[model samples]
Target chain A: MSELEIAGCSKYYKKNGEPMCALAETDLHVKNGRFVSIIGPSGCGKSTLFNIIAGLIRPSGGHVLLDGKDITQESGHVGYMLQKDLLLPWRSILDNVIIGLEIRGVSKKQARERALPMLKNYGLGGFEYDHPDALSGGMRQRAGLIRTLLYDKDVILLDEPFGALDAQTRMQMQNWLLDIWKDFKKTVLFVTHDIDEAIYLSDEIHVFTHRPGRIKATIEVDLPRPRSEKTLMNDRFLTLKKELLLMLREEQVSSN
Target chain B: MSDQLKDNEPFIEDPSVRTTKLRRRAFVGQVLVGVIILFLWEFLTRLGWLDSYYWSSPSTIVRTGWKAITQGTLLQDLAYTSGSTILGFVSGTAAGYILGLSFWWSELYSRIFEPYMIAFNAIPKLALAPVLVIMFGIGFDSKVVLAFLMTIIVAAIAACSGVQSVDRDLEKMLVSLGAKRRHVFMKVVVPTTIPWIVSILKINISLALAGTIVGEFISSRQGIGRMILYAGQVLNIDLVWVGVVALSLLSIVMYLGTVWLEHVLMKGRAPKS
Candidate 1:
């Protein structure tokens, strides 16, 4: 069964008394425990789609379903991580991580207990008590990821989580994310403009067209498991990269 | 080993050490300047370059202050003024913050009241002293009401901006994570507003004090303001100087107290060295 399904979902905004379509009618289905990614140009409605999926905003039409139940216009069902780390500066790392649990009415002590081992596992062990400002950019993103995971949602939406990291850190985070996703087996919808990142991490890649976005293509990533830095040099990886790059280049040119 | 030690010495001038050295120099400079000015004042008065009766030397002010202290009037007046200022500050800040939060929560309400709030803030609060004195009859409550009028507008504006400027992405993240409205408020909104609230509290201390003194000036049987007014009437320049010094010391103490509270609350979040 699909963990999440968006059936004919669309969004439009009224601007200066004229309606502007942000997202065209779109349909998506993510099988349980699979990783999916969406890639598009800058002005594309990728974020709008994510916002609707996360239930932060309502779709102009159609329905969103989780396990066959309509959940359109309802929030707090999925975990979301934005491009920015968004860690509360006032909170220590441990406190920030447990915010989701706290919102669910878990006791602080209990939330701390649940969050400690995850922090230690995520390479933020000793730094749990440190403020967000003390962390490196990559570490701050790690803290944000942990906070999202602690929410324990079945479907997680990652909107370019490594978009701001240095190249080396971004590669490292991609590997770390795969490791965690493999272990947890939670359904994931990742969004990025990086073709290499999408190819490296996703089981399926959804390519989006520019504004009033619609699914341009859905390509299956048939790369073998236990993918790593070595996979970047693989013949298959190069071929897939070329294919995605050409598609995206065409889209960018046409949009202009 | 000696060469290595010498090389390490340059790197040893870390920010903390530099800050301490700079702070110590600043303290010395401040004290030196103060001493020089006081000495010049005394010398000029003694040499008849300035009228002692009008300008009262530092020694004479100190003597008057000591006499007031011994007579118990200084302590009593200090307590009265401090008490009113504290009461007014606490209540005004609390009310202002609550109102600001409500305004943020309801956009329509804020729109309706924005013009009125701005108008009230624009008028000098000291102008209301006579009215407050009339209504409260020159008691402690009158001074507190004046202080409240002086402080509430600033506190409300600060808090309202703080709430409005909280990161939109952070709020979205919280909402996506199954957080309720209350959770978003406690975790995102309140913590974001804290620094603004602390800063306003520090500013409101001086404003509250100013309001209280003005109220006292218009009509009050006690307080440092009254002390200064009485000394001025009798032409006792030393006593007036003593009252001014005491008020300055009181403001410094209150400001320092607010700074300490901010340090404690902010903890690791304080700006890096």
Candidate 2:
């Protein structure tokens, strides 16, 4: 059984007396411990789809099940990261990491003990008590990832986690993320508008069409694990990027 | 002492240290200006340039304050005023925070109470102090009630806006993190409004003191306000100045104490970035 299953999910919104659709009969299933990427243009409801899977928003018409059980009503089970690295500035790096644990009713002492290993493993050992403002943007994002991963959840939803980083820092983060994922083996659903990122990180790519977003295509990335920016220079990565770009262009024309 | 070999050297300052030093220097400059103004007043009075009958010299005021202190009347009056001010401040702040939280929770409560609150606030509370004294008598209760009336209005307004002004993204983030309505209130809403509430409390401290002093002047047989009234009636300008200076000092001390308390409580708690 899959770790997450979204069957026939749809969402809609009304704007200025005009009916606008965000998702339409979208069905997706993620096997346990798989890295899946959802790629599309802006306003494609990719984030909306992730919200549905994470149970942040209820589907207008469908069911979201986890491991053969309906979890549509349950929240806090999935770890989510947004575009902005929303680290509480008042909280130290260690405190930020342990916030999810604290929220889930893990005792503070126990949470700190559990969090220490993760912090040390991620190279944030000596900076446990240092607040978020003291850290650089790249360091902040790394701490955010540690925050989500330390929650000990089997599924994680990353919404443009590295979208705020510079090009050099973003490349560094991609390598770091792949290493973390390789070790954790958790089910991952990453949303991004960057085609290069989609091709680089994903085991499989789901291309989304324009508004009232529907799946355009599902392309499996046949690349090896622990890929780098050098992989982007290779023919396979370029070909996958080309295919995704073409699909997005056709969707853009139709939506226009 | 011999082991501590001291070399005279200029201090190497951090950037933030230099900034702090600059701020302290500015504060000292303001204090020097205040001292200069006081010295001018004293000089004018001593030289007979200003009328000594109405405006007493600073030394005369200080002497009057010393006489009041020796007789223990100053301490007695201070106790009466401080007691009323403290009681009224605590009651008003508690009422304000509760009402503000209620307003945040229920739109219906806000609609019904908000307009009435505004109407009541607009009526000069000082004008009502006489009527309040008439109703509650010349004891501490009337003074406290007057002070409470003065403070709660502003505190409630500040708290209501603070609660309303919380960042929407923070609320959404908390909600999406599986926090229920009550949890969101406890975790996100409360922390965000604390700095605002503290600032409001600082503002209300002076208002609360004013309310107490006004009540004292109109009805109380004792207190700094009554002392001022008697001194003015007898044309003892020095005693009047003493009472004014005492009140000013009390207000400054209270404000600074509250600020220090805020620092202690809000340490590592504020979300400023």
Computed on C-alphas against the true complex, the DockQ of each candidate is 0.68, 0.45
DockQ leader: 1
Off by over 4 Å in 1: B1-15
Model 1 C-alpha lDDT versus the unseen true structure: 0.90
On lDDT, the leading prediction is 1
Instruction: Estimate, for each residue in B156-243, the C-alpha lDDT of model 2 and write its tens digit.
Output: 8877887887776655555556667786677666766777778887888899999999998998889999999988889887888999
Docking quality level of the chain pair in candidate 2: acceptable
lDDT of 1 by residue, B206-269 (tens): 9999999999999999999999999899888899999999999999999998889889867767
Q: Give the range where candidate 2 chain B is weakest over 10 consecutive residues by summed lDDT.
A: B2-11
